[model samples]
Target chain A: MLSVESLSCRYGGVVALRQISLTIAAGEFVALIGANGAGKTTLLRAISGLTPPYEGRVIFNGQPIERASCAQIVRAGIAHCPEERKIWPHITVQEHLRLGAFGRKDTKEVARDIDRVYAIFPKVLERRKQVCGTLSGGEQQMVAIGRALMSRPKLLMLDEPNLGLAPLVVEQVIDVIRAIHRDGTSILMVEQSAALALPHADRAFVLENGSIAKQGRARDLLQDPDVKRAYLGEEKQGRLIQDPLAKDPLATTR
Target chain B: MLDLLPQFVFNGLLIGMSYALVAIGMTMIFGIMNIANFAHGEFYMLGGCITYFIAAKLNAPYLVAVPVSVAVVTGLGFLLERVVFRQLRLKSAMSSVLATIGLGLILQNGALIFFGPQPQAIPTSFSAFPLQLGPIFTTEARLFAVAVTAATLVLMYVFLNHTLYGTAMRATFQQTEAAALVAIPIDRMRGITFALGAGLAALGGALLGAIFFVQPAMGATESLKAFIVVILGGLGSIPGSIVGGIFLGVAESLGTVVSSAYKDAIGFVLVIIIMLYRPDGLFKKS
Candidate 1:
């Protein structure tokens, strides 16, 4: 239930996003794959109202959110777990989850949602009292996802969820993303790792130079010769889908 | 002669608590909103002026005057946040510095024109009585300021740690963008912070007016003391502000006994020495 129409954004002299249009129905897991400087993160930032768009509009649940404040956009049911896992250093793990539900008024429902988040990431539950700054990279990613879940958003936008993590940790995070999608939250995940994301995403869009290069069923995109050659490296040619434990798609052509 | 050491220490601590009261709000503003708030001292002056107007001019009771002063300054602070500080937030860092300095000058001069240049005392109810705790001697006014400061600080600590809004405030301070994702109204949180800081500063001014004197220029000295306290504690650190205030107070008191002429210099000396060893302030690691 999210519609982004002809959205364009610029950072001073550079055009970060140009007339990009996309949509996500309720309960769909969508992935946006791209190389560095492909404007994947910028698209997410524009939709979340963190960056003002120079053209076009964003509609969520049939209401225009192009001019809304970042907080208002969140209240309207889109939670963005941004890049670098920007968790407050001094806050405890439990407090991070609590903040995720800051928009809600019902304490009982909020508490239940927190339990739901913890169920998805038990490591976060174990580190309830520990400050987030002390958490490991994977655990921090868990906290970021858990924090997004606390918002109970209709759509969750994740930027580089698998970045800078150990292989084992990446697998676990991918599993958590799958579990979250299975539980009925629409996800728009941006990743350089097409190998990890395409397998989990129901549909995918390949972004290049601030525009969509390809969009289709994830299964078809994985088998496409161009996508495979460009995104899924040659060394792991046949092993892309065969090995569920394959290493993440390397940052191709960075 | 040694028995008097406790007396000096106690006095230092009492004044230190007053400094803490003013510094608490300043630190919170800096922590969450990243505003140095040069006009913070003007809010203190406004509080004292309001109290003087209520208690002395209108002949109201001290109890009635104190809360009214705090409420008035708090409203003013909220207005400032909405009308001025919020806009400054989008501009460069120098905008906040310039806006606050300009606001401080306006408020200070406005007070000077309205209240005149003469120092006015609130004629506190507690000023008539002096309290003695064993060998230590103190006025009831000083005790009231210390007790209220301690109680307010403890309440602030609880609010920051225990409440949902408090947790949100802490989150906003740490990561503004993340806080927004959770639907914490960033602007609203900042306004609330501004109001609270102003209220605390007003309370300090009202209480200090009873012990010291209230003039248009009083905020200058008090805000300077608060700056010293904030720097000594560490910028944007609550615990740091408290410890720094007490340290400055004790140092000044002890230094005064040695040389009253150099008593004021004690805080500056301590700040310099503390910064040399721990540039982040005494309380914060960095």
Candidate 2:
């Protein structure tokens, strides 16, 4: 479980996240949706301890992780797959996976987990010996997720898993996230595509300008008129969920 | 003429041994830590001084004096890393340059105050008898230096190529952040890198002390030679260092045969011309 309380963070004088607070239970898929520069990435970076916060604290499993080093955070079972896909280009995919489990000492368990990840993403397994630099963008994303899984993390935080992938690749990746959560791993995903995120998330939070604009169960929020006018934008609205009254609700928005 | 070629070849090989020894450490340091340690040649002088004191004054045996000189200078390197290099850890390249130059100044003055700026020699007492290579006669001292230098260099090659830590250092050199993320301990690797560089410098200097007069300032000339070797070999390339070193040594020796005073000048001229054409040096790139 994770608890974020009144967290405020800044980049120089520009505020990135301000007094944004939320919580996630173990084994749940909670998506944070926002437009570009809406502080989703900054919030995740702050949680992962790669970025220092200006105010407030983060508690993971009853311990404060505000000042913990990135290594320390990983050791504490939180793996963050940054948006940049920061894989070592010259090192092989297997080597990247090995580095993900750097702090782990049990060789047997580590080997077992690597096998588990390989089974989950067979493309990464096929390209195990190839240098990660040569991997396709979708394959690279798979390698990144598989790498985070190598850490055996309790919470896997991913930023924009569908950023630049083809539509087919994006569908496959979102399916992977669903399957990963169903298998008992907690996932905190941030994406600009609220429609895609809403279908899989048990609960969701809409972020606007560094603060939580709304939070509720995904199904109820999907049918809300304000959620449509502000975020869903009614373009392909029928694809998400069929609310009979939701059609007129889009026009009656205050 | 065929017989005389072998003689010159033997001469070149012995001198190449010394060149390789000095340049190996230089290349390792520059490759990983990215600093030249302008004070490296002075480490060679320190080794020579230790050998001189232990052998000439304490009457220690030659065999004992050689390793002791190396160990003493190695300890000095470890100390310098701990006391000095650590301070400059987060500093820019300029800080490293200024700090090392200051350290070099300190070392130079320390040697002067203690050794009185005198040129001294360790009484090697080794045989001056020359082993004939067809038409040429090479002395025992030069042969020892050449043999030791070759053996050390081969060991260095193995360490850099085959071992886990060696591969890790090379990895760190290529990509620092990636290395750190994998818990390779970048700072610790740098310490080993510096020690390795300093130890080899001492070994090369001690070997040279057998033939040249061991003086407080001997590092000056040897450092110049080592710098030329690094430049010629190409920066940060291990094999390049060796090839460049031998090439420079042979060129200088041949230049000496023509006109001894212009040997260093010729090496410089070639270095300038080569750099203009190919700044990277003559080694396979990373």
Candidate 3:
């Protein structure tokens, strides 16, 4: 369980996240949907301690971790699979999995967990010896998710796991995510595609311009007219807006 | 000329091993920390000076002096990394370059003040008598230096390829953010890497110091050769540094047949050619 209370973050002079608040109960699948540069990635970075917040408290379980280092945050059971699948290009898939459990002292359990990851992604096992740069986008995405699981995390934060992925691959990844959630690992996913994220999440928070615009049950938000119009592209003219906030320079810069 | 070929090759191999040792350290620091440590050779110089102080002045055995000197320099490296280079990490690459250059000047002057301007030799138990090996001939001290360099390189290879810490270092070199997310203490890694790099260079200085004279200015040429080797080999490739070092050594050795006065120019020439044709160096990492 994690709670972010009235968090405000800035990148130099630009306010990336402005007094945002959200929470995830144990084993709950929560989605944060926002347009590009809506501070989705920054929120995850702030929570993981990559970017220190200017104000607010990030309480993980019962402990406040606002000033913890990235390594400390990871050791405390939060594994962040960052945007664009930041896997090392030259490192092998197996090595990536090994690196994921770097904080653990149990070598035997680490080895067992690696095999568990292979079982989850058989394709990753087949390409275990190969460098990640040589793998296809789908295989790389699988490796990224499998790598996140290697930490045995209590809370997994995935930032755009489906970015630049194919439709079929996205479906497979989402299916795996659902199964992982079913197994009681809480997930905090940031997705730009509202239609894709809403159905899979138990609850959702719609972020707009660094602030939480809407928060409710995923099923309720699915049928909300404004949510449908703004996010799902259900305009009166039946023409998709692509990105309604595309004109915002702040949106594009992030 | 043909009768002297083996001797030339033997001499080249000896110098080449020393060059490889120094260049490998330089390359590792460049690869992992992204710092072109201009003060790297000062570690080598300090190693020699410390070994001289222990073996000649303190009356310690040469074997004992070498490791002690290396450890001292390595400790100094760790201290400098913590106090100096760590702060520069947040600054620009140019800032680090300037800082290291200034550090080099300070170290060079510090050695000059402490050790004096005159070159000094490390007293060793090994005989200076030339040992005959088929067609090649070398002194005991030179042979010992070569043997030590070979063993150190083998150990370095094992550490980098087989150990968990080495793998973590390589992973950090490849992706800093991804490495941190996995709970690798990157700051600690940087400190250890800097220390290890300095230790390797110090080992080279200790071994070579026994064979040749140690002086404050010795580091300047050694550092320049290391930079040349790193550029010729590929900026951060360890194997590249080794091969480049040997090639430069052999080329210089052979250059003596034409004109011994310009033998040192061969390395600079080869580096220019490498830059013109293969700007990425001989072994570009994938």
Candidate 4:
């Protein structure tokens, strides 16, 4: 379980996240839905200790980890598969998984965990010897997820897992996400698509302008009028609308 | 010219071995920390000086002195990383470079004060007679240097490719933030890498000291050659450094055949032309 209290972060003078508080219970699936620059990625980065929070605190499994370095935070059992995937270009898929288990001392279990990841992602297993840079976007995403799982993390924080993928590829990844949740790993996913996220997550929070705008059961928020308008692109009449004339319909209501 | 080719190539390999040793260290530091350590040459100097003090002053055995010199230089390198480079690593890359230049100055001057301004050499345990095999010719010290360097390179390759820490290092070298997220203890990795690099530089200096003078300014020329090798090979690549070193050495040897007076200039001229054509260096795809 993870608890973030009044978290605030900035990029120079620009505020990326402001006074946001949230939590995830053990084995719970939580989705954070927001448009671009809504501080979704910033919040995940702060929690993972990639960028130290400018203000507020994060407590993970009863320990205050706001002051911890990225390595320390990882050792405390949180793995972040960051935005852009950040996979090493020349390294093999198998090496990425091996690096993921860097902190673990148990060789046998590490091998077992790698097998578990391979079982979940047979594509990654097939391309184990291939360089990551040469893999397709969807395969690379699988490798990123597999790499995160190699850490055997207590809580997996994913940033924009569906970003830049085709609908079919997105569906495949969403299936993997669902399977991961069903296996009892707590997950906090940041997404730009409420339709993709809300239907899957048990609990969801809507982030707007660096603040928590709404929080409720995923199903309830799915029907919330404001949530529907801002995220789901649905009319109050319970119908999905697509406007051909509107340029950049996915753009945030800034 | 054909008969003289073997001798030139033999000479090139001997000098190339020392360059390989020094360049490998410089390449390692660049790979992991993303810093061009201007102070690396000073570490090479420190290695020779330490070997001299142990072998000449204390009358220790050659074997004892070499390892001790390496150990001392490595410890100093770790200390430097902790006290100086670690802090600078957080700042701009230029800051680290400037800091290393400053460190190099201090180290060079410190050696001047401690060892005095004399050019010293480790007393060789080998005969002055040139070892000959058909058309090839070399000294015992040169052969020893080449043998030791080859062994060191082999061991280094094993450490980097086969070990857990090495895998972590390679991961860190590739993407530092991601490596940290996997709990690689990046600071420790950097420290170990710095120490290993420094140790190797010292080993190179110790080996070369038998054949050449170990002077305060020796590192100035040696480090320059090492940098040239790194650039020739492609920055931060280990195997590239080795091949680049040999290439540079052979080029220099061959260049001397044409005009001994401008041998160094010949090597530099060739490097510039190669770099202009492929700025990424010989090993890189670009």
Candidate 5:
């Protein structure tokens, strides 16, 4: 339902996404795996119209959207759950969900959809009135995803959904993602962790230095010797490693 | 001296409400647009000038003129936001600051040319007779100003807390990028916010124009007081601006007991003390 052809994006003199192309069919779960600064975020930003592309086209359901504003792109049925969760510190979780549907005119369906989101994340329902800043990282991540679902998009683009999340929490989030995919919404997820994403994706594209290095079925890429050596082997070594500074202690205080 | 204290406090409350009205608008513009909006005072000046023209020149009633003036200033605000502020949105904050300051100068001078330097008073139906309330006394116009300001404040609180647009505005204030991601028409929101802020300032000017004289140069002092209130209350905090405005007004009113010449200086001194100790102001947004 979405196609990006030979898209290129630049930041000042530096090229962030260079001649990249990808596609996702209806109900497909695609994973874009890349290292830090590999232009994964930039590609998503370009698609969502946050960053204007220097060249190429982004066609959503056969309509060219590279020139559309971020708001227009969202109205065209593409929801981008941006990096770092981007939760407003003082806004409540329920308000975040309502904000996700800001452009929709169906007040009745919007209210129903908010309840639907809560059903998907019961923890979010419990803290609907509480501000997001007070929530745990895992709860915040759930609220972010729930907020994205509030848009009722045809294509949901998730950028680093598992970033800074604990292993157990990551598993729960991935499971929820799988359930959502099973319910028939297309997802294009960007992840630095190949092993975490590949197992759940139908297809995968390995990105390197702003270009696509590999693209195929997820299972084939999982067994590819080079892919195994670079992504999976690294995962095995640091399976227990957790960045202590990922969660700020003072975040809740603010 | 003690008997006169209540009267001083009552006078302070009257002026403080006006300050609060202006400061709230300033704070809202700063919070959402990320612009200090040096031209904010111009909106207030235009509010009073427009009211004067409609009421005094056109022979319209004061009540009819106030809303008309607010609507006119609000329309002007939206036009300026579209033509001037939209272009400066992508530019640096310093550029916006300079642009607004220049805009303020042009507006001030424009008003000077149009209205001239003569001060004008809005003809109100309120009686000039002072009403004694136990140990305190105040004129009808002053009472009307306070009543209108308090009602405006309550209305503002309800609009902001209970409305969808207000929630979206608050969300935009906290996270612009996230707000856009959710398809909130952020540009439109900014324009509306700028207009709303302008309308608010105009309301203050209209109400106060009845109590005090409306001159082309009145905005400068009003703008200065707004800045002091914003800083004293904490930059983007609405409640802070309200409390800070009253504090400044009361302090300045009480300062007249010692020396009326130094009344304006009192707000500056309080602001200096606030900056030294609580740089974030009294109510930092949580």
Candidate 6:
């Protein structure tokens, strides 16, 4: 559904993404796991047309969309929910949804989809008239997802949906993600949590310094000693903490 | 003293009505575009010219003349937006100010070339008909000006509140990028808003010309007064401009009654005092 070849992104002289290449098949659920500054967000931005790559080709759904405007790319069926959740502060929940469906013209269906989103996220429906700024972290995240869904995107790309939320809320969000995937939307997700993402991701790619370090089925990568040491954190062996906050023991190999 | 009070109030209301029509559109532009439009008064002058040519020379009725003036001025505003303002493309207010200042000079001089520097009065069927309520007297022209301004204001309010485009415009005023992202066609809205503002300014000028006098430089003084009203009203608040205009009209009227020489200065001083006490006007309570 999406292809990237020789993608390199730079912020001034500093390279944020370097010589990256990856692909996602139609209807695939792919998780890209990375440490901080792993070029995950940069990769997403380039594909989503928020940031252009210094050198590369990005083709989605058989069209070269590397030069399309942000709105055009979104209308082309890729919805990007950034990590920070850039919800308009003063606008209401319904207004945010309306904005998400901005470029779309299917009036009746759009209204129906809003209802569907409300059904999926009862909390958002309850506070439909409330301003988005006042919602809790999890509720705001729901609104963000609901907004993306309003676009009726083919690929819903989420960057760190679990950031700064309670574990229970994360579980709730993950469940929503799973349901969204089951309902037939191809998803490309980036997660800091290795184990949680690994179990759900059909195919997983490890991004290190803007390049793919490793790729395989979730289960095989989960069992590899290197993957364990680098991402899984040698937890089963009790040699290192797998926690995201702790330093990985695999740095000795760096 | 009691008998004369009605005269002062009627006169103040007449001036205030003109101020309100012009200032509402100015506030709308400021609120949405954040540009003060230094050439607003020129548009007013253009409106008067259009009205004069249509109603007086072409023998069209006054009712027909008003809309033609508004339409011509609005079209001119749209052309200015597309040719100049849109090219500026999200520039700072200072840039808009400089551009408008230049435009103002051009417009005023252009008026000089075509219409000449002299004032023109409408040659109606009959002239100087007076209406007296007790001892207070007002001309037909002033009374018509007052009535038309109030009617236009009501229409403007309805256009702003009830229409989809109007709501979308309001949304843009609050947050431009967000409004654009929502497919509001922001550039189109901006151009339309500028045209609307210019149209209203022209209408006000035409009205003033009928009741008072018309000249190439007529819009300059009232434009300054309008600026004062906008500031006193608050930068981007429409309702504030109306209240601020009425207050200024009353203050100016009282100053005239007390002493006509210091009246302009007094109106400006009142604005300063109000600003010193409430910087963002009465609307921006937050």
lDDT for position A65 in model 5:
98
Model 6: how large is the Cα RMSD against the reference? 6.1
Positional deviation of residue B133's Cα in model 4 after best superposition, in angstroms: 2.1
Q: For every candidate, what is the interface RMSD in angstroms?
A: 0.9, 3.3, 0.9, 1.1, 0.7, 3.5
TM-score of every model versus the real structure: 0.94, 0.74, 0.93, 0.94, 0.94, 0.75
> In terms of DockQ, which candidate is stronger, 1 or 3?
1
Candidate 5's displacement at residue A14, Å, is 2.6
* CA RMSD of all predictions: 3.0, 6.9, 4.0, 3.4, 3.5, 6.1
Model 6: what is its DockQ?
0.23
- For candidate 2, what is the total of clashing residue pairs? 0
As for lDDT, the candidate ahead, 1 or 5, is 5
What is the docking quality class of candidate 3? medium
What lDDT tens digits, residue by residue, belong to model 4 across residues B1-286? 8899989987888788788888998998999999988888888888888898888899987778989999999999999999999988768899999998999999999999999889998875677898888898878888888899899999998887778777678778878888888888889999999999999999999988888878887787778888999998999888889999888888888878998898788658867987899799889643
True contacts kept of each: 0.88, 0.12, 0.76, 0.75, 0.84, 0.18
Q: What lDDT score goes with residue B44 in model 6?
A: 85
TM-score of 4: 0.94
Residue by residue across A1-254, what tens digits does model 6's lDDT show? 88888899998899998888888887889999888788999988888776778998998989988887666778788888887666655557887786678678887888899999999999899999988878998899999899888889899898988777666677788899999999999989997666657878888888888788999997888887877766765554422233443243222111
Worst 10 residues of 6 chain B by lDDT: B175-184
Name model 5 segments beyond 4 Å from true: A233-254
Every candidate's DockQ is 0.79, 0.20, 0.71, 0.70, 0.78, 0.23
Clashing residue pairs in candidate 4, if any? Answer: none
- Report the lDDT tens digits of candidate 3 across residue range B1-286: 9999988888888888888888998998898889898989899899899999999999999999999999999999999999998988878889998999999999999999999999998999998888999998888889888888888888888877667778788888777888888899999999998998889888889988998899998888889999999999999888898888888888889888889999889999999999999999988765
Runs of candidate 4 exceeding 4 Å displacement? A233-254
Q: Give the DockQ-based CAPRI class for model 2.
A: incorrect
Clashes of 3: 0
User: What lDDT is reached at residue A252 by model 6?
Assistant: 16
Give lDDT tens digits, candidate 5, residues B1-286: 9889998888888888888988998898898888898888888899999899899989999999999999999999899999998998888888888998999999899999999999998898888888998998878878777888899899888777668788888888888888999888889988998898899889889988988889889888889999999999998888888999898899889999999999999999999988998999978854
Docking class of 1: medium
